[model samples]
Target: MTGLIKKYIVYTAVLIGLLVFLHAIGALRPAEQYLSRGLNPLLATIYSWGTNINVAFDEQTGKADLWQQINDLQAETNQLISKNAELKAVEEENAILREYLNFFNDHSYEHILSRVISRGDITNVIGRTESILIDKGSTDGLRIGLAVVDEQGIVVGKVAAVKEASSLVRLVNNQQCKLAAGILGSEATNGITEGELGLTIKMNFIFQEVEIKKDDIVITSGLEETIPRGLVIGKVSDVNKENNELWQSAHLIPLMNTNNLLIVSIIKP
Candidate 1:
C-alpha cells in the first residue's frame, strides 16, 4: 500500500509540472486563436472531433424540422382536395333540382315525378321505337300516351308500355316518334321532327322555300296530344335542300343527353 501511494503521488506531480510549463509558454492562453498552432496534433485531433460532432448534431436538427414542415403541408393539401370533391357534388345536385323546378313553373297542367331505371327496352314493344325504362308505372299514376320529359321539360318521349312498377319511355329518337316542331322565331315555317339514332332527329316535311338557319331553336307545336307545346325538341344542326322532293332534310341536335339521363318527369294529362 505504501508503494502504491508513492506511484500515484509521482504521477500527479508530473501532470501538474507539464501543465505549468504549457501555461508559461502561453500554450493555454488565447485558446481559440492559438489552439491549432500550439496544441499537439494528437490533442488537436480530439478538439476537431468534438467540433465536428456539434456541427453534425445541429445539421440533423435542421433536417428534422424541414421534414416536419413538409409532412404538415401534405396533410393540408389532402384535406383541400377532399373538400373540393364534396362541394362539386352538391353543386351538381342543385343544378338538377333547378331544372325540374323550371319545368313545373312553366306548365301547370299535370305532372308526375319519375326516376330513370334502365335503358333500352325490357319487353321490346314497338320494333321501330327507341326506348328507355323508368321506375314509375301504373302505381305512380303513369299511363300510356303520357309524355316523358327531362328536368327542363324537354320532350323525351311518351310512355308506350308499362308494368305494375315500371314503364317504357319511347325516346324522341325513335323511328316512329314524331313531333310537330316550329322554328322559335319563325311565324310561317313549320315541320315535323322525327327521331333517328344517337339521340339525333330529322326535321322533315318542310318545303324548300322555308327559311331555316343553323342554331335555330325548335319547339313542339302541340299539334297532337302526344307532346305539349313549347317543349324543346332540338336545335337545327344542318339543312339539305332537295329539288326533287317538296321538303328539305334538316338535322337536329336533341336537347337531352340520352345516355346521361337520371331524372325525368311525366306529363300526366
Candidate 2:
C-alpha cells in the first residue's frame, strides 16, 4: 500500500511539470483551437438531425389536418344535394294540386275528383283502346256512363265499369265511346262522333253543305242523357268528303292526351 501511494504522487508531479512547459511555449492555446475545429462538424451534424426530426413531425401534423377538412366538406356537399331533391318533389306536388283547384273553380258542374290508379286491359283490335282504372267507384257516387273530364274540363272518357272503390274508364278514343257532337260556328253542323279504331274520332252523318271546316272546335250536343253540352271533344283536323256521297265526315283530334292521364273529374249530373 505504501509503495502504490508513492507512485501516484510521482505521476501527479510529472503531469504538473508537463502542463507548465506547454503553457510557456503557447502550445496549450494551439491545441485548444485544433480540438475545437475537429469537434465543429460533429456538433453541426447533431443540430441538423434535430431540426430535420422536428420538421418531419410538423409536416405529418399538417397533412392530417388537411385530410380532415376534405372529409368535412364532402359530407356537407352530400347533405345539400339530398335537401335540393326533396324540395323539387314538393314543388311538383303543389303544382298538381293547384291545377285541380283551378278546374273546380272554372266549372259549375257537380264533379268528383279521382286519381288514375292503374291501366286496364288494352284491347288492340282496330287501334288500341286504353282503359284506365280510377280510385272512385259506387262508393263515391261514380257509376257507369259518368262522363270523365281532364283538369281543363275537356272530355276524356266515360266510366264503363265500376266496383265498390274502383272504376274502369273507357277513354274517348275507345271504339265503343260515341258522343253527339256539333261544330262550334254560325252554321253549326251536327254529327255522331265515334272513336275510329281507338285512335281518332270521326264525325259521321254531317251534311256536305253544312259549312264545316278544318280546325273547327267540336263540342257535345247534349243529346245524350249522361253528357252535358259545351264540353269540348276535340278540334276538326280534317274534313273528308266523297264526291258521290251526300254526307261529309270530319276527323277529330282530342284536346287532352289519354295516355298521360293522372287526375280526372267525373261529371255528376
Candidate 3:
C-alpha cells in the first residue's frame, strides 16, 4: 500500500511542475486561443443548423396558407357564375312582358294576352301544320271561334278548343281554319283563304276577271260573325288562274311565321 501511494504522489507532483513551467513561458494563453479557434467552427455550425430549421418551418406554413387562399377564391367564382345566370333569365322574362304591354296599349280592340305554350299535335308535326296551345283558357274567356292575333294585330288563329287553364289555337294556316278574305286593291276581290300544305295559304274561288296581283294585302272580310273586319291575314305571293276554270286562286305568304310565335292576343269581342 505504501509503494502505491508513493507512485500516485510522484504523478501529481509532475503534473503540477508541468503546469507551472507552461504558465511561466506564457504558453497557457496561446493554447487557450488555439482551443477557442478550433471550437468556433463547431459552434457556428450548430447556429446555422438552427437557422435553416426555422426557415424550413416557415416555408411549409406559407405553402399551406397559399393553398387555402386558392380554394377560397374558387368557391367565390362559382357563386358569381350562378348569380349571373339567374340575372340573365330575369332580364329575358321582363323583356317579353314589356312587349305584351306595348301591344295592348297600341290596339283599340278588346283582347286577352296569352302565351304560346306548345306547338302542333302529339304527333309533333309542327312544321306541316299550324296548331299551337296557348296559356289562356275558358277561365280567361277564351272559347272556340275566338280570333287570335299577333302583336301587330295580324290574324294568327282561332281558339279551337278550350280547357280550364289552357286552349288550343287552330292557326290560319291550318287546313280547318279558313278565313273569308278580301284582296285590298281597286277590285277588292273576295275569296275563301284556306290553309294549304307546307304552311301556305290559298285564296280560292276568286273571279278570273278580278284584278288580283302579287304583293296585294289580304284581310278578313268580316262576313263571319266571330272574326272582325280588316285583320291582315297575309300578302299575295303567286296567282294561279286557268282559262277554262271560272275561278282563280292565289298563294298567300303570312306576315308572321307561325312556328316562331311567342305571344298573341285573343280577340274578346
Candidate 4:
C-alpha cells in the first residue's frame, strides 16, 4: 500500500509540474467555468450545513426559555390569587363590624366592643366546660358576674372570672346553666331555659296552662341579679304539648353562634 501511494504521489507531482510549465509557456487555458461549477457546490453544501446547525440550537434555546417563563408566571398568578382571597375575607369581617356599630348607635344601647382573645376547644378534653375568653376584664369595667353579649344584644355568656386585662366567660350552653326567659307574644309568661349542651338551651318549667309557639323571641327577665332585663336569650324553634297534663315543651335556638363570635360586649351594670 505504501509503495502504491508513493508511485501515485510522484505521478501527481509530475502532472502538476507539467501543467505549470505549460501555463508559463502560454500553452495552458484557465478553466473558469469548471472552477465556478465544482467549487461553488462544495462551498454551498458546507454553508447550508452550518446554517442548519445554528438554527436548530437557537430554536432549542428559545423553547427552553419559553417554558421557564411560563412556570414563573404561573407561580406569580397563584400568589396573587391567595392574597386576593385573604383581603376579601378581611373586608367581609369589617363590614360585619360596621353593621353592628350602626345598630348599636341607632338603638342607643349602652355598649362596648370587646374582641375575642381565647376560646374553648371541644377537642381539648381538659376544658370541655364550653367557655370563651375575651380581652376585657375587671380593669375594663368587666365584673365577675357581668353578662357577655353579642353585637345584636343577644346574651352569649356571663363573665365567670376576671383578671386585670382578660376574663373567662361561661357560655350560655353550659349544661348546668339556667336563666329566666320571657316568651314574646305570650303576655309576659316566663320560663326557665337550661343549657342542654354547648349547642342549645332548653326552656322548660313552663306551667301546663301556658301557651307557647315556635319563632317566639325569648328575653332575659332580669328577675335575678345575674343577667340584665331585655337581653336576647333565644327564639323558640319547636313546641310540643303531647298531653294536657304535661308542661308544654319547646326547643330554643340561641341567638348567637358561638363558633363565629369575634367581637362582643360586656354589660357593666
lDDT of 2 by residue, 1-269 (tens): 99999999999999999999997786785665455445535544554465456545655776967855764674464344323333443454456769777533233679999877665576575325467777666767888887888866677888999765667898877777778877653324389887887788888999877777887777776677887666677878999988799899999987665544667899887
**Poorly placed runs, candidate 2 (over 4 Å):** 1-107, 123-129, 186-189
How does residue 102 of candidate 2 score in lDDT? Answer: 50
The weakest ten consecutive residues by lDDT in model 3 span 81-90
Tens-digit lDDT track of model 3 for 44-132 = 45544654565456557769677557546744643443233334434544567697775332225688997666666635344354787
lDDT of each: 0.67, 0.71, 0.71, 0.65
Could you tell me the TM-score of candidate 3?
A: 0.56
Stretches off by above 4 angstroms in model 1 are 1-106, 121-129, 187-189
Per-model TM-score, in order, reads: 0.54, 0.56, 0.56, 0.53
- TM-score (C-alpha) between model 2 and the true structure: 0.56
User: What local lDDT does model 4 show for residue 62?
Assistant: 65
User: Which ranges in model 3 have alpha carbons more than 4 Å from their true place?
Assistant: 1-107, 122-129, 185-189
Pairs with backbone N, CA or C atoms under 3 Å apart (clashes), candidate 2:
none
Displacement of the residue 207 alpha carbon in candidate 1, Å: 2.3
Candidate 1 lDDT score relative to the true structure: 0.67
Clashes in candidate 2: how many? Answer: 0
Pairs with backbone N, CA or C atoms under 3 Å apart (clashes), candidate 1: none
